[model samples]
Target: MQSIPYSVTLRPKIFVFTVMGTYAALAPIAVSSVFQHLLAVPMSVLLTMVSVCIFAVAWIMQREETSFKALNRIGISMILAIALPAFLSIAASIYALTVVQSVEYVAYFQHSLLNRLINIGMFATLSLLILFFIQKDVRKVTYSLTQGYFVGLSVLVAGGVWQFLHFTIGYPMPGFETRAFVHSVSEDVLINFRLTSFTDEPSFLVPFLIDGLIIGGMLLSKKAYSLYAIPAVLVLLLSFSVSGYVNLAVIVFSATILLFARGIIPKKVGLYAIISILILGMITVLIFPQLITALFMPIIGRLDSLFDVMHHSRLYMLVFPFVWLFDYSSINALFGFGPGSYDFLARTKYLSHQGAVSGTSNNAFIDLLFEHGVFGGLVFICVFIGVFVYLWRKRKGHLYNSIALLLWIHLGLTNMYRSDFASPRFWIIVLIVIGLTELAKRNITLSDRRASSSYKKKVTT
Candidate 1:
C-alpha cells in the first residue's frame, strides 16, 4: 500500500474537521423556549475562535507568493467587495445612533451592527485563509468536504426517519425527545407533522439537505459513493418545503445534464435510470397518496399564488419595504435605517394590522436596502456581478464551477423569498464555491503560462 505524507493527511483532516465543526456549531438545538442558548451560542463562539486560529496557521504555512500586481488587484477588489460594505454597515449603525431617538431601537441597531460586523469579518478572514492555503489542494479539500457531507446526510436521514416514526407513533425517543412540532404550508392546510429531526426548524434542515444533495451529486459524478444521496433526497421530500422541492428539482436536472454530457453515465443507463425513477415515483405515490399530497400540495399552492397578486402577501412584503425606505429623508435614503430596524418597522407598521406573522422582509435584496441603504446595496450588487462575471468566464469545463453557478442561481431565486445570508450553512457553501472557482482560475493561469513557455522553447529549438 502506498503511504501518504503526514502533512497531507493532517491538512485535509484539519480542513474537513473545521468545515464539519462549523456546521455542527451552527446546528440549532432548541432547549427551553426562552433559554435556548446552550449549543447554538457557545458552539458558535468556539467555532469562531477555532476558525481564527486556523486562519493564523494557514497564513504561516502559506508557501506560494502571488505576484505584486496580482495581489494589488485582488487587494483592491477585496476592499471594495468586502471592506466597503462592512464600512457602510458600521457607518449606518453610527448614523442610526445619532438620528434614532428610541433606546430600544438604538440597542437593537447596535446588536445588529455587531452581528453584521462579525459575519462580514469572519467571511473575509476565512475567505482569505482558504484562498491562501486551500487553493493548492482544492481537490483534496473538496473531497474531504464530500466525505463529511456524506456522514452528515446519513445522520440526518436516520434522525429524520426516527422523528417521523415518533410523530406517527405518538411517542418520543429518550434523550432525543421531540423538540417542536414543525409544520409546513401543506401541513397548515392538511394538518400533518413535518420532519425537523435534530435541527431547529424544517426551513434550516432543508438547505443543509439540498447542499448535501448537490455535493453528493458532484461526488457521485466523479465516481464516489452516490447512493448516500438517496437518503438526502428522501429527507428533503419528507421536509415538504416548497423551496426544498424546487432546489431538489434544479439539482437533479442539472446533475443529469452534466453527467450525461461528461459521459459519466452511458446514454442507455441514463435513460433507464430516468424511467426507473419515474416508475418508482408513480408507485410511491400510489402507495402513499396522503404522503404525496403532504409533500407537494404546498408547492402547488405557492405556485398558484404567484398568479393571484392580491392573495399573495409576499409580493407586498417585497415592494412595501423599498417604498417605505424611499419615503425616508435623503440621509436615510442614502444610508438607510440601521440593521434590524426594518423588522421593527415591519412589526409596528406592517404586521400590526396584518396578523401574527414575524416582521421579516422576506426578500434579501429588499432587506439589504432597508438595513444598509442604497450605497450598501449598490456595493453588494457590484460584488455579486463581479463574482458572477468571473464564474461565467471560467466555468466552461469545470464541474465545480458549473455547480457553483447553479447554486448561485438557486440562491438568487430563493433569496427573493428569504435571505440566505441569515443561514450559516449558506455562507459555508458560498465560501466553498468561491474557493473552488478561485483555485480553478489559478490552475488555468498556471497552465497557460506553461503552454506559452513550452511553445516558445520549441520555436527557438
Candidate 2:
C-alpha cells in the first residue's frame, strides 16, 4: 500500500469506494454496460466485486493510517448490517441442507465447497467493510435536494432512452433485447404513435420513469421542477398499466405531505396548491378527454385482468412461499433465503408452466418476505423506516429528506425492482444521499457538543 502524510487524508480511497458503492445502486445502466463489454462482468456481479474490493482496499489503507481508523467506525457498521444476515444464511443453509440429505444435496455446493465458501467469505468480508464506512451524513438543505434530483432523474433518463430504442424503434441494445421480445405488438400496446417510444409495449417504463421524476419534482421548489410533471405524467399515463395512476396518486400525496412537513412550503400552501391543481386537472380532463383517455385510461383496463389472475388462486405466487417462510426446517426463515432465491423458485415455476412469467416479482414486500424472511424483512423495512423517521425528525428543511421520502415511495410501490442495486449510477446517487445524511448528522452533533462545552466554560469563567 502507498503511504502519504496523514494530513493528506486518504480521500482517493474514500472517493474510489464511493464510486463503487454508487455503481452497485443503479442497475439499468450497469446491465447495459456489462453486455457492451465496457465492463468485464455482469453489472450485478461487478457491483458486488466493487463493493467487496473497496472494503478490502479501504481496510488495508486504514491499517496504515491510525488516525483514520477513528473515523471509519461508520464503515464497520455498514459491513455488519449488509453481511451478517447473508453470511449467517450461508452457514445455516448448508447445515439445513446437510440434515435433509447430505452436503451434496445442497445445490450451491454441488459443484465444489471451495466455490461456495469463497462466495460466502467474500460477502462476509465486504459487508463488514461497509459497516465500518457508513455513518449519518449531514447534508445542507439545497445541496441535498440537488443531489436527490440528480440521482432520481439520472435513473429515469437511462431507463427511458433504453426503452425508447428497444421497444418503439425495434432496435434492441444487446442488454435490452428481452424487453423487445416480451413487449411485442401482440401485447396490444402500439395503439398511439406518439406514446410507443417508451419501449414497453404495455408501458411498464412509464410508471417507473414518472415515479422517479415525481420525486425530483417534489424536491424542486421552482417552476423548473413543476414543469417536469407534464412529460412525466404523460409518460406514466401512457404506460397503460392501471396501477400507474394509483402510483401517481400515491406519489402526489406522499410528495405533498413530505414537502409541506419539511417547511419547504407551509401545509396551508400545500392544501391550496392541491385544490388549484385538482381544479385545473378537472378542466383539462374535461376538455381533452380523448388525449387523457388514450394515455392514462388504457392501463386501467389491465387492472381487472391482473386481479382476475390473482383471483384464480394465483395465491400460489403469493402463498406457496409462506410454507418456506415459516419452516424452521429450512435455512430461509431465520437468517435469510439469500438473494435470488425467490426468483429461482419463480423461474422454476415458469419453466414448468405452472406460473405466469415476468422477470420481476409483482410485490416488493412479498418478494422480500420470501427471500430474507421475518428477520431480514424486519431489518430491511426498519432501516428504511428508521431513515425516514430520522430524517423527518432530525433534519429540518433539507431536500435530501424529500429524496429519502421518494426512495421510500419507490420502495413502497408494490414491485420495486430488486435488481436496482446493480447500477453504478444509482448506487453513486444513493451513496451520496446516505453519506450526506450521515455527514449532516455528525456536523449537528458536533455543533451541539461545542455549544454545550462553550456554555460550561463561560459558567466557570
Candidate 3:
C-alpha cells in the first residue's frame, strides 16, 4: 500500500493531540478553587472555548474532506434523540409560562429555559466538533482519547493522595482553601477524612475513580493501567459517597449477570475479573482498616438512606422532581414545567410543603423526566437503550467495545447523581467510543475485501 501524504496526516494528528491534551488538562479542574476563581467562568464555558479553538483547527485541516456523508445512521439517531427533546422542552416551556400563576414563577421558567438552551448548545457544538475530527481519521483520534483518559484519571489519583496527606498530616499545599472549597464536613478530617482530591466534592470525585477501576481493570488489560485501580479503590473508599457505593454495587451485580449468568463476556475474562476483585478487596481491608467501613456502609447502615429521601437532602432533591411530576396536573406531567423548572418548584412548592433546603434533582433521569415530560424522557431513555444494544452486539475482542459498554453502564448509573451533562466525563467517552465503532467497521470491510480478492485469484489460478 502507498504511504499517505505527510501533509494530509500531520494536521489531523496535531488536531487530535491538541483536543485530547486540552481535555485532559482542563476537564478535571472544575472544582479547583484556584482555577475557579482565576477563570471566573464555569467549566462548561471553558470547555466550549477550547472546543471552538479545536473546531477552527479541524475546519482548516478537513475543509475539503468534511461532508454530511461522514454521518451514519447511529450518528443521525443520536442527533435526533438530542434535538427532539430540546424542541419538546421549548414547546413545553412556552405552555408552562402561560399557565404559571405569578410573575415570579414566569421568571423562573424563563431562566430555566435559557439555561437548558446554553447546556444543549454547548454539548451539541462540542460533539459536532469532536465528530468532525474523528471522521478525518478515526484510529488516530480514538488512540489519543484513550491515552488522554487514562492520563487524566492518573492525575486525579495523584491529587487525591495529596489531598489525603494535606488534611491528615498537615502537609502544606496552596489553593486547597477548605473554607471556599469544602462543601461539607462530617467527622472532621482528622477522624474520618473525606478525600475530595481535585474536584469540588467527594461524590464528584468518585465516578472518575470508579471509571479508572472498572475500565482500566476489565477492558484496558494493561498491568500499569490495572495498578491505578489500587489507589482508585482506596480513594473511592475515602470519598464516602453513598451514590458511589450504590454505583459500585450496580457494577458488581451487572457484571455478574453479564459474565456468569448471561455469558456475554468470555469465561476466562470473568475468572480474571473475580480474581482482580478479590485482590482489590484484600488490599483494601489489610491496609486501610480505618477506611474499610465505607465499603460496607452503603449495604448496612446507609442502605435505608437511599430510600429515605426526606432525611437525605440529595435523595430528596432527586425524588422531588418525580413527586412534582405525578402530583401536579396531567398536562404538566406530560411535558414538564420545562428545563430548570425543578429548581423553582423545589424552592416554591417543595420547600413550602417539606421545609427542606433548596436543591435541583441531582438525578439526570429524574431531571429529564421532570423537565421535558413523559414523551421527551422516554425518547432520551430509548436512545440509551439503543446504544447499549448496539455496543452489546458489537463486542469485538474486548477493547473499545467492552470499554464503551461498561463505561456507558457506569455513566448511566453515575448520572443518577451527577446530572451535569456538559461535563467531559459524560461526552468524552461517548465520542471516543463512537469513533472506535467506526474504525472497527472500516477494518472489517477491508478484511472482507482482502478475503474476496484472494478467493478470486485462487479461482483464476
Candidate 4:
C-alpha cells in the first residue's frame, strides 16, 4: 500500500471537520446574541463566509494533480444530475425578471436571485472539493467525515439538552437568552416545547438528527460502537416535528426490509437494536409520558382531517401547489413567475390581509416549480433520481450506500412538508453520498487491476 503524504492526510481531516463544524455548531452559534451583537452580522451571511473560507482552504491544500480525464469520468453523472436544473433555474430567473414589470416583483426577484446563486455556488464548490479529496484518499476522507459527524452529533445533543433544561426551569442561560426564545414563542399547545438545540429551529435540528441516525445506523451495522445513536435518536424523538417522525419511521421500515433481504444483520446486533429501542421507549414513557401522547395526537388529528373538506390538511398542502402552478399561464408554466413569486402571490392573492407571507411553499418540488417553472422542477427531480440510481447501481453492497438510499427516501418524503433544499443539511448529505459512491467505484477498479496483474504474473511464471 502507498503511504499518503502528511499534508494530504491532514488537509482532508481539517476540511471534513470544518464542514461539519460550520453546520453543526458555528451556524447556530452565529445566531446567538453573543455573535449577533458582537459581530453585527446575520447567521446566514456568517455561514456563507465560513463556507467560502473552507472552500479556499480545500482548494489550496490540493497536492495531488487531478487528471482531466478522471474528472470527466466522475463528473458526467453529476453534470446530468445538477447542471441541467441549475441552468434552467438561471434561465427562469432571467425570464421572470424580463417579463414581470411590477416593482415589488422585481425587487423580490433580485434579492432571491442573489441568495439562490450564492447557495448553489457554495454547494457546487464544496462538492468539487469533496470529490477532489475522495480521489486523493477515499478511506481517510470517509473516516474523517464519519468521525466529524459523530462529534457534531454529540455537541448537538448536549446543546439540545441544555436548551431543554433552561426551558423547563424558566431560567435563561446568560448571553444566550435568544436561544430560549423559540421554545417560548413556538411551543406546541400539546407538545409544550420542541427542542431545537443549537439549530435556529426545530425543523433544522430534525434533519441533522436524521442524518446522524443514518450514519450511526450504518456504523452499528458494521459492528462499530454505536452509543452515539442513542442521543441522536432521542433528539429526533424530542423534536416532535411531524415530518421528522414520518421520515424516521420510513427509514426504519426500509432499513429493516433491506437488512432482512441481505441477511447480513447478525443476531446479536438485531437483539441490541431491539433492546435500544425498548429502553428508549420505556424511558420516554416513564419519564415523560405526555411527550408520547403529544407526539401522536397531532399525527392522529392530521390523519383525521385528511378527509375533512373544510380543513386544509397536509395532503392539501402537498397537492395544491402543483395544482396552482399548472393553472398558470404558459409562459409562467415554462419559466416560473420567478424566485419568491409564490410567497409574493400568497401574500397578495390568498392572504392579502395577513401581511407578508413569511413561509415558503413547504414543498421543495412545488417551490422549484413556482420559482423556476416546469423545466427547472423536472430537471431538479431528475438530478436526485439520477444521482440515487447511479449510487445504488455502483455502491450497492456498501453499508453507506444503504444509508444513503434511506436518506434519499427520507428526504423525498419529508420534502413534501418542508422545503429543505435551502438547508445545508440537504446538500451535505447529497454531496457526501456522491463522493462515497465515486470512492466505491474507484476501489473496485483498483481491485480489478490488481487481480489482472496477478493473473499475468502467474501466466508468465
TM-score of each: 0.72, 0.66, 0.79, 0.73
Over 1-461, each residue of candidate 1 has an lDDT whose tens digit, in order, gives 34566667577457645664444334333111222345566454445556667666655655557543443233235435545654665666676666666675566665655665565566566555554444455554444444554466556666777777776786676443333443224334453556766765566566666666665554454334355666566667767666667766876686676567656678899999899999999999899998667546655545755545445566666666767776546676776676555655644454323563345666667777777778877776677667667665655555556667766665665566545344444455555565456545554321224225454233212
lDDT of each: 0.57, 0.48, 0.66, 0.59
Candidate with more favorable, higher TM-score: 1 or 3: 3
**Preferred candidate (lDDT higher): 1 or 4:** 4
In candidate 4, stretches whose alpha carbon ends up further than 4 angstroms from where it belongs are 1-45, 57-69, 72-83, 97-99, 167-191, 219-226, 266-295, 298-318, 323-328, 339-343, 346-349, 352-356, 394-396, 443-461
lDDT of 2 by residue, 24-100 (tens): 33433334432335556444555567667765775676664334345433233333444455466556556656454
Which lDDT tens digits does candidate 3 get at residues 1-461?
33568667676668656677567546656545556666566665676666766676757765466676676445556656666676777776777666666675677765766866776777677677667767766666666666667677778898888887787797876566442132233322323456777777777788887777764553244666556877788878777776788898888776565555334567789889889999998998999975655444433454554566666667676666666686646777787767666666655754323574454566767777877788778887898789989888866443445556777788788878875554566777677668657755665211224224454333212
Cα error of candidate 1 at position 254, Å? 3.6
Residue 325, candidate 4: Cα error in Å is 3.1
Candidate 3 yields a Cα-based lDDT of 0.66
lDDT per residue (tens digit) for residues 5-35 in model 4? 7766676667555575445444334333445
Greater-lDDT candidate between 1 and 3:
3
Per-candidate clashes come to 0, 42, 0, 0
Off by over 4 Å in 1: 1-36, 39-42, 61-82, 96-104, 169-191, 220-226, 256-316, 352-362, 438-461
What's the true lDDT of residue 176 in model 3? 61
**Model 4 compared with the native: what TM-score?**
0.73
CA shift of 219, model 2, Å? 9.2
The candidate maximizing TM-score is 3
lDDT of 3 at 384: 79
By summed lDDT, the worst window of 10 consecutive residues in model 3 runs over 179-188
